[model samples]
Each structure stands twice: as structure tokens, then as C-alpha cells.
Target: MEHSRIAVAGASGLIGAALVRSLAADGHEVVRLVRREPRTPDEVRWDPERKYVDPAGLAGCDAVVNLAGANVGSRRWTDAYKARIRDSRVLGTTALAEAVASLDRPPRVFVNGSAMGIYGETGDRAVDEDAPPGEGFLPELCVEWEGAAAPARAAGVRTVFTRTGLVVSREGGAWGRLFPLFKAGLGGRMGDGRQYWSFVSLHDEVAAIRHLIDTDGLSGPFNITAPHPLTNAEITAAMGRVLHRPTLFTVPAPVLRAVLGEMAGDVLGSQRVLPMRLLESGFTFAFPEIEEAIRAAK
Candidate 1:
């Protein structure tokens, strides 16, 4: 793959940070676009809320990856919180798309961040990139998020929406929260324990993004999840096994609802997503199984 100048928004966040490191290690010149005034040479200041970006700073970049968004699980989905979630993704994406589209030498590819929640809760049925989006807040948000990138696509830039699953990592994400509980032998399934927990290792998530950047033939939504997905019960068991702990507790649906409100659906909803397009593209997964991924992260 040719090393190209890449600009990444949301560079301080989990996935964004990982991508910055990966891009740098791959020998690409990475410029980080941040909200605050950049104090370093590698960073560029841009405020998505204000819809302002220095186009000169974005010039000469061959690719751009937008990962800016409000943390969905950070707060209760009151009307205000819901609006923030929608606005954050839509506005942030639109800002980047407009900036890229206006560039005289615009980026050749735009790899935008999205989520598998776009497909809603799919129970045990496997959904891929081609699956029609289902229902609920997440699906609707993802639709608008992807739509915000339409300008770049319409301008002839190769756009890819990375529909990510539950990215398992020891440093952050759900795995970080679950590790302590499982280690204490209090971790268990929420609700029925039958809901599928579609997931990907942090390693595979980064690799697939890089793979997309290299494979020009790939565009549109690509499921950034492991080939093998597991149900909540299975995930609990695997984590228990990995931590050498017991998985005997169960959080009732009503109790979870009381605690998390609408966010509880995030814990209970099922999304059995698969990386059909990525696999068909000949991209190999470093950790395809839940147990193996858990052990590697541990």
C-alpha cells in the first residue's frame, strides 16, 4: 500500500487514537484534527460545533477518517441527550465532508466511522454490510451519519462507512467495564442471555480499516466485526473462562431498565453482525473467535 497523507478527526478518542498510531506506523504522514487550538505541528485545530476548519491545513491529504461523535453511553437519552448524539455525528460528518469536497486536491478516500447498531437488534440472524438498516435510535442515527458523508461521495471520493461492532479491548470499551466485574465473579448475562453480542477485537478493527485504505476496490459499508460472533451467554462464559472466574449472576430486564433506561437496550439488544464483505475481499482476521480475542486483550 502506498503511504499517503492522512488527516484524522477525533484523534484523542479510542478508535481514533488507535488509527493514528496505526497510520503512523504504516509510514503515512498523519495530521490530527482537534477541536482545540493545536499546539503541536502534527495537530490541526478545527471545531465541528462551529462548522469551522482551516482548509489549508487539510490540503494535500490523500485520505481522511472521521470518528468524531458524542459518546452514546455517557448519558441518559433524554430529548436533549438524543439531540446531541444526532447532532454530533451529523454535524461533525458534514463539516468534514464539506471541507474535503471544497479542497482543490481533495482526499481520494474517506473512511467514516459508523456502528453495527445501524442494523438494529438482529437476534441470531447474521447481518452484513448489505443488510437493510433495522429500527431504533442507533439505526436512524447511523443512517444520518452516513448520509452526512454524501457530499464527499458525490464529489467522487471513495467513501467507506465502517459499521463497527462491540470493539473488545482491555484499555476501553465494554470489555474494560466487564473485566472488573467478571474478575470479581459478579459478571453475568443481562436479561435473557440469548441476544447476540456481535464483536471484533481491537486488533482486527484497526487492521480492517487499514485494509480498506489499501483496497481501492472497497467502498460503502463494511462490517468491521469478527467472522465468528457469539451470544451474550457465550460471551459471559468466555470472559469467565479467560479470567478464571464464575459467571452465575443474571441482571433482570426490569432492574437493568431501571438502571440504564433506554440505554439498557444497548445491553439487551442483539446484533449478530458478520464481516462478509471484508472476508470476501480476502482480508484475514487476526483473532476471529471470542475466547482468543479475550485472551489476546488480557
Candidate 2:
């Protein structure tokens, strides 16, 4: 694929930063959309809460990738925090979608970020992108979150909703917390440890986004998880194997709920997701197995 200029929201985030680096390394010009004042030539300012972005600033980008949102598990999911989670996603996505649509020369594609929680708990059932949404606040949130991108899709941009799985990275996300705990022999399975955790290496996550940007005839939702989904016990074992730590401890579901509150359900929930669409589109994962992903994160 030929290199093209791209506008990226949440460019400072874990996946976003990696993408910016990857795109730059591949010789693509990246314009970062920041909330603060722009300090560089490649930065643009936007206020998602107000649905504001300078159309002229994003006028000629080849693609717009919206990865901005409050981290769902960043805090206790209190009533106000829950509102923050929903609003952050809907507002940011809507702002970007409208901005992209309003541009005289809109980008060819819009890669909108979403989550696999859209499937809720799949409990031993292997699910793909075609699976109907499951029940939960997350499923509903993801639906509306993805829906906020309608403007871009309506403007004829090939919009792709990326339903990401547990990202295995030391930088942050699920692995950030897990790595330290496992290094100190403190890592263990949550609940009964049977809940399947569909995951992808951070490397693959960024690569998959880049793939979507250039791949033609690909629109709508694509699952961005490893082909093999590991249960919580399997993940714990993999971590112990990679870190050479003991994996004898197990945290009860009740304990998790008491500590993490509503967020515990997500930790203990099963989401055996598969990147069926991405594989069908000829994209290959660099780390598709638990051990491979864990070792790579090491």
C-alpha cells in the first residue's frame, strides 16, 4: 500500500502512539488530533465534548482514525464515571465523524475503535464478527459508540468499526497490570478461571489498523482478536511460563466483584472472539497463540 497522510485522534494513547510510530516508520505523514493547544506542525486541536474540530486542518488526510475514549476500567464505574465512559466515546466519535464528513475532501476510510465487550459473555462459545451482540451495558454502549460514526459512513467513507480484544502489551491495557503482578509471582486467574479471554498482541492490533486503512472493499465491524482464545486459567499459565513465576493463586469472583465492582464482570466474562473478517481479508497475525503473545510482550 502506498503511503498516505492520516489524521489520528487519541494519538498519544497506547495503540494510537504505536500506530503513529508505525505509520511514520512506513513513511506516512501523521497529523495528531490533540485536546490541548497544538505545539507542532503536525498537530490539530479538537474538543469532542463540544463537537468541534477544524475542518480545514483535516481537509486532505487520506484517512481518519478515531481511537479517543475514556478507559472503561480506569476507575470504579460509578454512576458519573459510567456516564463519562459513554459520553467520551459517543462525543469523540461523533465529533470526528462530523468533522470528517464536513471536509471538502473527506478521507477514504474511517477506522473507528470499539470493544469485544459488544459480545458480552460468550461462555465457551467461539464467536466471530458475525455473532449477534450479547446483553450488557457494554454491548449497548459499544453499539451506540459505533453508531456515532454514522456521519462519516453516510458521507461515503468506508467506515470500519474495529472491535478490539484484550490487548497484550507491557505499555498499558490489560497486560500493563498483569506483567508487574506476574513478575512478582502475584498473578493468578480471576473467578473460576474458565472464562475465555480473546486477545491480540499490541503489535498485531496496530498492524491490523494499518491494514484496514489500505485494504479496499472492507467496511463495517471487524473483530481484532487472536484466532486462538485462551481461558483465564490458560492465560495465567502462559504468564507464569513466560515470567517463570508461580501460578498457584486464584481470586474468587466474589472477591473481584467486591473490589472492581461492575468492572469485575468484564474481567471474569468470557469473550472467545476471532478475527474472522481480518483473516478472510488476507491479514495474518504475528502472534496468534497465548504463549507467543505473552513471550512477545515480555
Candidate 3:
């Protein structure tokens, strides 16, 4: 791949940090947009909450990846919390777009972050990039988030919205949180465990991002998930198998609803998403199956 200067917003987050490391390793010049002053010169300070970004620093970049957003699952969706969640994404994306729009030499591509929640609960139906979005707060937020990048697209920049799935990694992410419980033989399915868990390994997540950055033909919403999605029960079983633990403890739906409220719906919702666009674009998946992804993460 040809080396290019890249700017990554939200460079402190899980995906952003990983992408920065990967890009740097791949010989690409990476400039991280941060909320605070970086201890090093490679970082650029930007305050999205304050609506200020260094537009001058953003110029001359080949690509810009926006991964800024509030953690949706970090708190209950009180009306205020929900508003914050929505605003964070939209505001951050809009800031990036505006900054790029003002740049003398704007990036050629803008890869923005989104989530599989954009598709809502697809149940058993396999969804793809071409699939219409579904209903729910998350789906709605994703739609607005993606829409916030319109200025960049209108500026002739090829924009790519990555609707990511459950990112499984041993270091941090959903798998890290579940590892201890499952390892202690107390891991179990949430609700009936039949809901499909669309997932991808962290390795594949970063790989797919790099692929999209390099592949100019790729644009629009691309589902960044493994080809072979599994149900909650299957995921529980697989984790148990990997850890040599029993997979008998099942968290009842009523309990989950009582504890998580609207968030519980996300845990129980079914979304059997497919990466049709990535596949058609000839982007090969490093870990297509759950077992392979799990073993690699393990």
C-alpha cells in the first residue's frame, strides 16, 4: 500500500488507538486529533465538546478517520444521557467535516465510525450495507451520525461509514468484560441466548479499516463484522469451550430488563448481519468464523 498522511479523530478510544498504531506500523504518517495536548508532536489537539479543532493541522492529509463518540453503553439512556450520546457523535463528526471543508488540501477520503446497531434488530435476516436501516435509538443515532459527514462527501471526498459489530478482543472490549465471568465458570447466556451476535476480532476490525483506507473504490456503509455470525448461546458455548468452563449459568430476561432497562434490549436483540459490500469489494476477512476469531483472541 502507498504510504499517506492520515488524521484520526478520537485517537484515544479503543478502535482509534489501534488504528493509529497499525497505521504508524504500516509506514503511514499518522496525526492523532485529541481533546488534550499530546505528550508528543505527532498529536494534534482538538476539543470537539468545545467545538474547536485545528483546521490548519488537518490540511494535506490523504485520509481522515472519525471515531469520536460518547460511550452509549456507559450509562442508562435517561433523556439527557441519550441526548448526549447522540450529540457527541453528530457534533464530533460535524466538526471534522467542517474542518476538512475549510482545509486547502482536504483529505481524499473520510472513514467515519458507525455501528451495526444502525440496522437495529434484524433477527434472523442477514443484513448488508445495501440493507435499509432498522428502528431504535441506536439506529436513529447512527443515521444522524453518518449524515453529519455530508459536508465531506459534498466536497468530493470518498466517505466510508463503517457499521461495526461487537468487537471481540482479549485486551479490551466485550470479550474482555466477559472473560472473567466465563473463566470462573459463571458465564452464561443473556436472556434466551438465541439472539444473533454479529462480531469481529480486533485484528479484523483494524485490518478492515486499513483495507478501506487503501481501497479507493470502497465507499458508503460497510458492515465490519465476521462472515459467520453466531447466536448468544453459541458465543457463550464457544467462550466456555475456550476457557474450559461450564456454560450453564443463564441470565434471565426479566433480570436483564430490570437491571439494564432499554439497554437490555440491545443485549437481547438479534441482528444476523452480513458484510455483503466488503465481500463484493473483494476484501478478504482474516477471521470469518467465530471459532477462528475466538481462538485467535484467546
Candidate 1 structure quality by residue, lDDT tens digits, 1-298: 7778999988887788898898899799999998888898878888876667777888999888988888887767888889888887888899898888999889879999999989998887988888899888999999999999998998889999999888888777778788888988999988999999888988888899889888887899999999888889999999988899989999999998898889999999988998999999999999999998998788
lDDT of 3 by residue, 203-242 (tens): 8999999889889778899999999899999999888888
* Candidate 3 regions with alpha-carbon error over 4 angstroms: none
Global lDDT of model 3? 0.88
Each candidate's clash count: 0, 0, 0
Q: Candidate 1, after superposition: displacement of residue 122 in Å?
A: 1.4
Clashing pairs in 3: none
Q: Give the true-structure RMSD of model 3.
A: 1.3
**TM, every model:** 0.97, 0.98, 0.96
* lDDT tens digits, residue span 68-107, model 2: 9888877889989998889889998999999889988889
RMSD of each: 1.1, 0.8, 1.3
Q: Residue 118 in model 1: shift from native, Å?
A: 0.9
Residue pairs with backbone atoms closer than 3 Å in model 1 (clashes)? none
The lDDT ranking, best first, is 2, 1, 3
Q: Which ranges of candidate 1 are over 4 A from the true structure?
A: none
